[model samples]
Target: MVSSFSLFISLILLSLAKGIQGATFTVVNRCQSTIWPGILANAGSQPLDSTGFELPSGETRTFQAPPSWSGRFWGRTGCQFDPSTNQGTCLTGDCGSNQIECNGQNAKPPATLAEFTVAPAGGQDYYDVSLVDGYNLPIVVEPMGGSGGTCSSTGCVTDLNRRCPSELRVGSGAACNSACEAFGTPEYCCSGEFGSPDTCKPSRYSEMFKSACPRAYSYAYDDASSTFTCSGADYMITFCPSSTSQKSANVGPLSISATTGSDNGPTESGDGPLGINTSWLPNFVTGSSSSPIPSSSSWTWPFMIASAYLLFSSF
Candidate 1:
């Protein structure tokens, strides 16, 4: 009887361990100002903990993502939220939900986005720090302790807002607007006749963003260079990651494999790479939900297993 009970307990623990296998995202705000980190899971996917939360400067928070999770994350600046009404707005990267938690809402463009698709096909995590929406903050996505395939750190380390074109500038040195956002033309927005990569060529405006951040998506068609793949890795998303002037510059150690030679060099149009075809995947819908399911569901099985183990031992 004792042997059978021990075997059952062992099986339960093993199942519990397997259930928790997934990726963790450590979000850090290294900026001198406060930032509210926002998360938007892909439509029909399980949401993570608190879609948005206030992250004071120099603070860090970690959240787990279930297997095959896909989403985008951005930092919101200058926000004021009220718990009573659950309504508010942010100066930059606002989801316009009138609340702290985005609750499945996507950020308005002109905000830098850290996009991710974990455990996608081929067992690799595809990720990128995209400026295609535009630029608001200096963000970095560093993969930590992952095996298989080159896990390179990708982000816009340079402050694009400082060098934004006069016409494409948003606020007084706040965020840089994408050419699409600035002009809204078919050529700039990559819509209508110019939707294809051959038609919608890189403009001089996008070149500025590409020059500043080669590893990030400067436009909608940028994929080959910007998309990085890593297997079984936790990611660190840092906003305003440590500049030389700050004492708390060293947040943590990072390991980056060198980018593939195919996409490393600059192109004729100043885009990171050329000759890469653009393939359209099913798009994730961006909207809002009132109540999202909690992420604590993963822990329930473990708790129940522990209780069962204790009960079996007592016998």
Candidate 2:
């Protein structure tokens, strides 16, 4: 019977090419204005293909995701909407989803996440770029071709709404609120019992957002260095990422030197560490890593996994 129906349609196209071979997420923006990005897909992943759109300022937008697939992405700043019922609203990551498509809705915090998971069979693909639900703008997450050795690049291209903190600014500045949205209690909203992490620790406005985005994820257990990993990767996700300087005329406050680990330089500290008052950080905004995840020894990935298992046993 025609070679068993062409080996059952080539074994169903190699099992749908293993979910289209997972990962590939591009999403640049380089910001000058025009934002709207949003995505959600987490609790039981699978939803990629526009969960929101409109990029504009230097556009970019690629997609695809299937293997483990987890998500979270943000960027919505100052929107308007309403070109005939497209509804509107957004001054910062709004995912109340009036229209721009955040169908599964999520980002509605001070907003500035990236988060990912991927990796199912090729394994290892965590990622990060959160501001612990606060910090509207500046994101990074590079990782390409990924194959371990830690596949680097994480973000927070620091423009911290011009150093917010006249009580988490937000209006004249546009976004920067998250001392648990300006002091809601439970000690900056770790919650109820300061909810673990051995009872909420970091806070001086999350150590000045961890001294200006030191690998993002500033508060909420921070996860060691704000988690990062890669293996069989492919992700770009830039936003105000050209390596800092997203408009700054020195908004003020920055005696710096909050001391803590190293990224090769500055880490001093004096009247800091919760003693607060490092002027308020007029600079620190670090981010610079994008090269690693190269190590490959040959046999072309075991000869393409034994030629896809002998073409799925000759289908």
Candidate 3:
């Protein structure tokens, strides 16, 4: 009985960790206008259904990715394309493919991005909504029909395009630029001495972003609370997700109490979660925005432990 139980427990653990081998990503365009969505698989990962496509308002599409696959998804705005020859230009998030499909091309700057790394067998998939590149629109990645706990929803549900600082704002406020993309400094870009987590620090501009979207990656090193994990779950990637008029809830383990525009507290250029004074920022860098970023609630350790307890109790 003991041997049989041990083998059964091991099998159950593997299933819990791997989530039925792969995952399905459902992309929904909830924006007011039509937007072009782009996809790019990581170097070694298999391709999804389409590299790029037109998602009209209120339309929904889905893609399936194999286990161990990794890639990014983003949206392009103000696009004018010719389906006949598959050519066009976008005001933001263009993959530079000059056509409808990204064809392995990555999204250009000023694009809100959703990234994922589906786990191989016996592993937990990782996902995040990043502002490391910049923000073109609001987005939310909700894990579908899975056990709760750390497997919760995440993403930037705010229209950061409107609140974008003047210097970082793209033409007509179509997208917002990250400080790193705007300045290209080692400090803002988290390169050189600032490359490591210990040396890098968030700039005032990044603080402003953190203030607006508390759960997103405000800067390059914003990792502790920026990444999430899950097993055996599908995802709903919603573009222009409804903007919530509230500050994000406090982080569970990190105890990060962040405030947003809706909250009655500090504004962008003031003290918030970082505990760093945000009185001033360098003169904003003016130019076209460049590409990339990360979210979440808990680590997988607890989930595994919970699974173990449940399995043992059943035994």
Candidate 4:
């Protein structure tokens, strides 16, 4: 019974993790011994699915989320070619052709190394902007503020006080406020539910982390009842333990008081069989404009124990 219960708990945690992201890890063996054959046999498998690989008692090395064996994980570089057919390869250099063309739908243009520039017209009432970007791909510049930007707007993010710049809007603020409130304030943007954050924000957050920690995997966990937290050092220089930790509740735990017999404090518990159950406040993260990662929250060991108990009871 205990084993089954433990298995159930493990399954719950694993399931929750899968809902967030799917990845693989590859463990390699550097030892020169056959002491453990089957253990480290397929250590270099694709998807890096396993947590750890067996080793023959030597310096074993492994990587999380190793490149997919089937080539399906082509990533940004894979977009240039069909991974399923092309196998595992990158189309980095030129395509050996000049007058290149891109077909509709799944067509990709060849790669190039070029420079580009965009300048305003000189000594005239017109602008003659030049374009260069190695690839020389056509560039599009739109007036975000409905073409009202005049490069003279005051206290406005854009040229005109009409709209916020795309950078401020968070990749075309089709939602949310464009104004990045005083540097440290949460930039509330528009969402499908109006006056809420959007999925695009998280995607942008992922991009920021990738830029900051290119090698390490980045995860943004939000339990609604808990605050937004991260898994790194105070400045990203040192590494924090990858294992999960506790996060304090903005509103502390409930405590029973003898006073009203029905009410204690804001977070106090009461002994009334017929009384309503007051819920704890939902956890939240005050996101910042400059950083993609929200503030970190530290959890307590006691809370973790209680959580484990609650989950076990449910099972």
* Candidate 3 Cα errors over 4 Å, as ranges: 1-21, 243-315
Looking at model 2, report the run of 10 residues with the lowest lDDT sum. 277-286
Q: What's the true lDDT of residue 284 in model 3? A: 9
TM-score for all models, in order of appearance: 0.72, 0.32, 0.73, 0.15
* Off by more than 4 A, model 1: 1-20, 83-86, 120-122, 245-315
List per-candidate RMSD values in Å: 10.9, 17.1, 11.0, 26.2
Tens digits of lDDT, candidate 3, 203-228: 77777777656667888888776788
lDDT of 1 by residue, 82-104 (tens): 86886889989999888888988
Error of 3 at 263 (Å): 12
| Tens-place lDDT digits, model 4, residues 1-315 | 676577567655543432132222122222122111111112233322321122332332322322112111100121233334432222321122211111011112211111111111111011111110011111111111111112110000011111222333322322112122212234222223333433323233322222222211212221121111211111110001111111212322122222321321122462122121222111111012332222121222344566667667766
- As for TM-score, the candidate ahead, 2 or 4, is 2
The per-model lDDT (C-alpha) reads 0.72, 0.72, 0.73, 0.21
How close to the true structure is residue 240 of candidate 1, measured as C-alpha lDDT? 79
Q: Could you tell me which 10 consecutive residues in candidate 3 have the lowest summed lDDT? A: 285-294
Model 1 pairs in collision: 87-98, 88-98
Best by TM-score: 3
Clashing pairs in 3: 19-232, 109-290, 109-291, 130-293, 130-294, 132-292, 132-293, 133-291, 133-292, 226-295
Candidate 3 TM-score over all chains jointly: 0.73
